[model samples]
Target: MLRITDARTGDPVTATPARRGLTRVEARVERPDATGLRVLLTADVLVRALEIGGTPVWTVLTGTEDRAELRARARALGIRPFEDERDGGPGPGLGEAQVLRVCARTDEPAGGLCVEVAPADIENGVALDDGSATALRLALLARPRGTELRLDAADLADAEKQLKHWRGAVAGWATRPSGPIPDPVRDQLRAAWEDDLDVPAVLGVLRKVETSGTVPDGARFETYAYADRLLGLELTRDIGRGTPA
Candidate 1:
């Protein structure tokens, strides 16, 4: 019942298109019994390894004991065993394709867990550093609200469109009267114009101009002008507010 996600996209499985016609993927142990779990490549365990882009990439292994027993053995060996129910994956420099990895507590009695590290690639694509990618993917999933803001190709395009429209709206306001502007309108324009600016700064300005509890119609031009000057964007059609000297 333990759930795990990649540190980058906050998903259990993340695919990377590092090579054409081949797919790179990453997964982790939901929770380790100790601090780090050893990976195994058993027949049953790897059957569920999903394929992406027609390439089945995974290796499988088996462990000697259940989570608890493995942890004890790991501790006795001086290497901190993986934590229980904690997510883990291999480190970087490990190839990504055609390798099945299972995180389990080890029970090797000879003072060492039987280490099985086999690296391979799918479709001739280069392998990834399994350990680094897993750690990064896990870190990404741990943050709040971080999952919502991932910028993909479509998102970037959408933002670009919005920016264009916002710029046009500001241009329209710049040419017309300047009495009051709705806070929402000003906020949107400010956001669009500032592009990569922080949201708090814009919100602060909104609070300041909204003291009367009403959105000033002319605030559109005023706010646009203010933001343009503050953020250094071209307020091309500034009519009411004189161009900054």
Candidate 2:
């Protein structure tokens, strides 16, 4: 039931695994630039979502980019390591798995669905490596995949603030007995991520849940914990810190 907008057809397509029990995904990350990082992040998100839904994923990262730096940054961003990491030019021999060409729009499509990501326009004083890596991730996820990411100091600051608030809130809620996630909220969260990985929409659901008076605190905690499985935001990190003051 996982649907993603195919860059080739420009339409939503069901991502069916070629193999019965496993899905093979290849992501071409050409450079260690901003767009390249975005590509890596996007591919990671897709792979994680598939795995979360009970599909074993075999991920391959192939490109001429500096593998060391790329792997380092991916780890910093909380992206898991790919199963097959190789360095080569285009046309690496691939299996029947779905292919994702993560590159700029101007780059030639490497024979799969092209995920076009524009380079981030960071402000003069803003350094991507400076502050909270999790916040940087949130800022990136806030935008649609194909849109230009105009990251600035304000965006990073806001993302950091929101991340802190959510962690604190989750911690406070965790003090109460755990409760089941409401069916409607759970459905909404699943629908958002399943629909072409609409992470922004998923985040919107979290925002609403945060302020909803009807959802008991325990349920709120469970809701966030459920969403974090796909979000990878570490939303429950503060659970043992005893709620923030």
- Give the candidate number with the greatest lDDT: 2
Model 1 weakest lDDT span, ten residues long: 109-118
Q: 78-173, model 1: which lDDT tens digit per residue?
A: 222222322334432245432223322222211111212112111222222422222222221122211122323343344334334445556665
Candidate 2's C-alpha runs over 4 A off are 17-20, 83-97
TM-score of 1: 0.25
Model 2, C-alpha of 86: deviation from truth (Å): 5.4
Q: What is the lDDT of residue 60 in candidate 2?
A: 82
Clashes of 1: 46
Provide the clashing-pair count of each candidate structure: 46, 0
Pairs that collide, model 2: none
